[model samples]
Target chain A: MMTLKKIAVPVAALILFGLFWEFLVWVNGWPNYKMASPSDLWPAFWKFRWLFLDYGWDTLWRTVAGLLIAVVVGVLLGMVMGFSRTMRDALYPLLVGFNAIPKATVVPIIALMFVGQHDMNTILIAFLISFFPIAVSVSIGLSTLEPEYRDILAALGASKLTIFWKIALPKTLPEFFGALKVAVTLAFIGTNLMEIVEPHGRGLGHLFDSGKISADYPLMFAVLIALAVMGILLYYIVVALEHVFAGWAERTPQ
Target chain B: MTDLIDIKGVRHAYKTASGPLPVLDGLDVAVPEGGFAAVVGPSGCGKSTLTRLIAGLMMPDAGEVLLQGKPVTGPRATVGMAFQNPVLLEWRTILQNVMLPLEIVPTKMSKAQQEERARSLLALVGLEGFEDKRPSELSGGMRQRASLCRAIVHKPEVLILDEPFGALDAFTREDLWQTMHRVKAEEPFTGVLITHDLRESIFLADQVVVLSGRPARTQYVMDIPGKGPRDLEELYTPEAAERLNILRQQIRIAQGRAAA
Candidate 1:
């Protein structure tokens, strides 16, 4: 009953929001080209569902590829930073500085370099944008390799690599997964940014650009709805993976 | 009996930003093979440091820490240690945690053989059904029990315990004192326990060594009256009470909390 009430409030709020948007457009005497109402947007969504799926699939795969590369690179760099103080001092500031730069500005430069291959630019830019959080989290996790646990391993005569494999990696899993959830969202942001920079890279961003140029307001709102749902779907996939990999965490009493 | 663990004229100190903070100065400790010895001292007197030195986790500044008459330059695989906290890997099952040391130090024993030993050790500690449970699932007492099992599963020549029950409630701590005694009795490893509780030390240790304040040096050593077949009830006897009082007084003086 409580959970149902929780669901009911959100659904009711959504309905009120849709009605409010409809009323605002009506009050302004906005034309169809300027604004899309709930009624018009619903039917338009059904009509362009296939197109949304095609472009959504493209965006999703590019995000996944970018995130995959980010995981590999970020984890390697994070390990180097975590273990070696000298290397961390050398590389950490550079990573933070690189991460600080505007990814949007970088995307155009990448698009220029790749030219017609905007898809590669999209993935590369997405990877660049999403790399830092995972690397930083992994380094933090490795560094926090509990002193007590390390001492126990040391007392047992476990070598450095053995200690890492036995204690550090397993200890860092929750942090790794936590970083993944954040990285996935950042990856989606980068994908959308790149697609907007070069609409030739097929995705919801391209559809959004086409909607604007043609002034197909209903189609534009529909694409926006599709992008939101796709983001939600991908985020929940990472959440489910977290459950699979770190289920013991859920069962932890404290 | 030969000394399984021996520290002669050992001096250890840590460097702080302020200056050098001395902890142990010309300290000596020895435990005979298969004997359980407890080192009791004022808090912050570096009792844990003593355990670390014996385990070869740290190099002593000026003297030799020997296990079976060889200098301990680094952590030797034959030294097993269990700290106050259980420190079991949360990701591993109790059985797997017990079997962890075998993975670190290569053993000729087959996986199946080591596994059987792990299971048996868990069973010995009354954790048979809990073999598959993660450390977080168990109570604090149970986790510490598992930690003890893990330390002994590899059958180290010397087992170093740093206040294994210091965090437990009085009742649980007492319960585990029996458990500790039982484990030591059964396994017969040369044992060194670092604890604050004098009763606990007297109840479990064959000889209780008391140390003085900072830059700790042995002030006194009480041979708890027993060779074998000791009981907890014996702790309350007049002779034991006098000994316990002496031990407490010595530690009190060591901590500068009371007159000698």
Candidate 2:
């Protein structure tokens, strides 16, 4: 009952939003080619369901593969950078400098290098854009042990390896989860944005580009709907992982 | 009695914008083996610094701290210490926290034996059922007890407690005095406590060492004559009350000298 009431307000608001959207389309008096109502987008979803599924699978697998690469490289590099002063000073500024460059601009260079393999282009773009956040989060997690806890462990003669396993690694889980929340969404955004760069590609971004040229507004709306659903699904997965690893953390606020 | 832990003419300071802010000025302390010594001083009197200094957590700039007749150049791997805060890691369960030292420092005991020791230590502290509980689930006093258990589980040569009960309420603080005594009795380790409470010093230790103000020295050391079970009623008795008053007066005199 509590859960139902909790969702009731947002559900009602969505219904009103759908009504308002249909009313606006009706008042515009434009044909379905120019404008789409909620009802029109609904059937269009069923009509292009296969196109949506296939393209979505392609984009998702690329994004996830890229995200996996980012996690591996990011965490390893972050740990090394955190442990050594020389490595941190050498790599941190370069990383920040690289992160500063708009990843979308890197797409054309990556696209040229890959030359017609948009799948590779999409994955590279996603990995390049999303990797830095995970790196920064992991480094911060490694750095921020409470002095007393460190001292207590030190007094017990804990070596760096022990400290990493007992203290640094557990503290990093929350930050890794937090960064994953941002990086995963940005991975999808990166793939789609890069996909639009090479519109001859086969992802949702290319489909949207084609729909725009053909003036099929409902089809574009259908792509937007799929993107929204996919983003929520990805975000919830990270949130679930956060709960699994850092569940003891929910009670305390720091 | 042989001195097991020694701080010899220790001179240390922290650097600041103005200049060097001196803490310990030719300060000295010695604790015999299997003895409990409680240190009492004013706020900011370098009491905590003295604890760290003896524990080898921090080095003295111009002097040396020796444990077991050898200079302590780094954290004494076998030294067990606890602060006012439990300082228990949030990520680890109470059992894991207690077992931490065994994992870090090489132990002769098997895994099962080490775990058995941790469980028994928790039970000794009245936290038997809470071995699996996270530090956050326990109350402040319970957490401190768990921290105490963690400190002694490894059975170190020395136990340095810096205001271990300072944060607790009066009732809880009194309760833990008994708990502290009971634990120390069960496992005899050289104990050094840095605290602001004279009564706690008298109640918990065989000898109470008082410190002067900043850039502190050992101003006075008084032996509290008692054995076996300690009772709250004893603290209010004329002799114990008078001893506490003398210690309080000694601290005021030390502070006065520091002010001068």
Candidate 3:
């Protein structure tokens, strides 16, 4: 029953939000081209559902591929920074400066370099934009390890590698998952930015651009709704993974 | 019985931005095989530094630490330690935490044997049904019990308790003291307990060592009468009261409040 309430509440809120948007459009007498109401979206959505799926899958796979690469590289770099004071001091400022650049601006430059390579550009952008948060979180997790825990293991004649695997890795899982959640959203943004900037006729961004050119506002709104649904779905997947790997960290006694 | 742990004229200091801050000077401690010694001193007088030296986590600048007639050059697998915080890994259940040292210490026991040993230790400490519970699920006393189980699960030659019950309530601390006796009887290891509680020292240890103020040295040693599964009731006797009074007086002198 409690689980049902948790699922039902957000879904009911979504329905209410759709109704409010529909009411506002109807009350203002907005044309379908000016703004697509909930009524206008369903037929258009039904008409192009298959296309939406294809393009959405394209975008989703690119984001996922980039995120996988980011996880590997980010974790390695984070471990390095976490363990070595000299490397941390050397790399920290460069990472901050790189993260500060507008990824949107970088997307165009990436497009210029990898002309017509839509998938590669999208994946690279997603990777570049998303890895920073994961790396930073992982480094922070490793560096803040409690001294007492280290001493406990060290007293047992445990080597540094043993301590890393036995203590540091498990201790850092919660933070890793936290950064992954944020990175998932950022990966989507990076992929979408590249798709829209290049308009390679392959992903949801291309479909949305096609809708704009034909003045089909309903189709555009359908694409926006699809993206939102996809984002929410992906975020929940990360949340589920977090529960599996770090469930012990989440428990609170009654 | 020979001394299992010996620290001879050990001295150490920490290098700070200002200069070298001396913590221990001419410090000496010893614990015979299967004997427990409790070290009590004023805070910041290097009681902990002395534990680290014996455990080989750090080397003393000027003196030697020996275990079983061998000088400790680095951490050996035979010294087990518990701190005030318990320090059980949050991700591991009580059983897994107890079995951690077994995983790292190169034990000949098979996996099943290890689990059995850990289970028996947990049962000895009154945590039989709590094997699968996480550290946070247990109360402070229960968690400390689990920590003790973890510390001695591998049957180390020496066990160090660095104020393991300092954060516990008075009743829980007393309960844990009894538990300590129970654990020591079942799994005999030369033990060193660092605590500030006078009653705790007298109740749990065969001998209590007191240290003076900073740049600390051994100030006094008092041997408690009668050991082997001590009852808490023994703490109320007139002899117990005299021991407590002498310890309090020694502590006062250690704190520089009373002249020796």
Candidate 4:
């Protein structure tokens, strides 16, 4: 299919870039400890595949759990804010102030709060990163109903609850998916950052930290590759969902 | 035979930055049961405001709008409306969009009955095969047609259209006019249309009420002279052209007054 061709271009380009990178290292006679070649990383990955998989699964579960909770809470808050001007006025400033704080700075505090539970710390980090986009996107989506559509519903004698279910929820779906895509990537990054700072969690970040401590450049490179693969996979999962919900929307005049 | 709608000395104004600017000034009109009427005027003449009032979407400051012998209070399900934009829910398929009113009505109809009614309406609009297609997949004219189907699917006693075909191309507009005429002929609901197109008013409406500019009031009420089943060819007649020219002049005068 044409879509496959489009995807193939970027994938082929990435493979070529990896080959070019390996060629550059080889030609320059760079030390393996300084910059590991793709060939070196591949052997290292094979040796540590099971260990990498366990870490990846742990981080993945934490991110997924955190993202789900954020979506549920964020959507409810957003709906309340969107439908009630009083609620928005009361809470929006507080939310903005909270969002303004540097999320990275909270990792240490979160770790301290959670103490020994690595899963709890990771979840907190992911939630902090993912919540903002979902809330903001849902609020915007709820507010962006066409005036005529609103008027039509109002004129039809639709109750507030009916309007929310039939109009608001359906209209907000595409936007929610868009926000979800961003949140998923952020969730991954947030979980990884939490791992990096703590260095005790079972995650790619812990793997990378161990590699650095042992001067294992090839292992670190392999972990970075795995992280890239995971990010792409998670992002595509959101994309697939967007396609399901919004496939009807894309046929409009662009 | 009581009037289906009575707009009695309705006055409305908006609080603008400048001051309270009046829009509708003691306007009054009566529409008989099952009558097809059109309100035509220049852009600022508040024709849309009148439709909104009749549909009970807004209240007049100084007067009352009566629907079926009751004073219009708020939006009522008995009144169906369509706008220039199709305003179809992008997420719903054509059948689902048509079935929307059924869902919101609070009267529990069996799902089978709703689907049957939706299909009947879609068939009426010549969209039987397009029941599963999304609004985004339809053409502008097709979408408007679907909107028309949606508006009437619930079988409301009154239907209000605000420039329903204004966004379509000339050929498509003419085609839809015929479609509308046929639908109106088949189902005898009290239909009120607000439009700037003079020919459209004459071709479709039983009575065309022309309005003066803002603070708008009814300037002229002309009876469109046509018997059973008119077509696009009627638009080419001298009578149609004369009516159109008269409307154009009245709109110009109204525009001049608004400017002054």
Q: Could you give the TM-score of chain B for each candidate, in order?
A: 0.96, 0.95, 0.98, 0.94
lDDT for position A52 in model 1:
81
Against the true structure, candidate 1 reaches a TM-score of 0.91
How many Å off is the CA of B246 in candidate 2? 2.2
* Retained true contacts (fraction), each candidate: 0.83, 0.81, 0.93, 0.83
Model 2: pairs clashing at backbone N, Cα or C within 3 Å? none
Docking class for candidate 3: high
In terms of docking quality, how is candidate 4 classified? Answer: medium
Least well predicted 10-residue stretch by lDDT in candidate 2 chain B = B251-260
TM-score of chain B taken alone, candidate 2: 0.95
Please give, for residues A1-254, the per-residue lDDT of candidate 3 as tens digits.
Answer: 98999989999999999999999999999999888899998998899989998999999999999999999989999999999999999999999999999998899899999899999999999999999999999999999998898998999888899899989998999999999999999999998888888865488888888888888999999988888899998999999999999988896656
Q: Write the per-residue lDDT of candidate 4 for residues A46-123, one digit (tens) a residue.
A: 999899889989888898988998899889888888877899889899899988888788888998887878888998
Candidate 1 lDDT, A158-238, residue by residue in tens: 888988887888788899889998999899989988887795668888888888888888888888777777888889899
Top candidate, metric TM-score: 3
The two-chain DockQ for each candidate, comma-separated, is: 0.75, 0.71, 0.87, 0.71
State the weakest 10-residue window (summed lDDT) of model 4 chain A.
A245-254
lDDT values, one for every candidate = 0.86, 0.86, 0.91, 0.85
Off-target runs (Cα >4 Å) in candidate 4 are A1-11, A84-100, A251-254, B16-19, B106-110, B225-227, B257-260
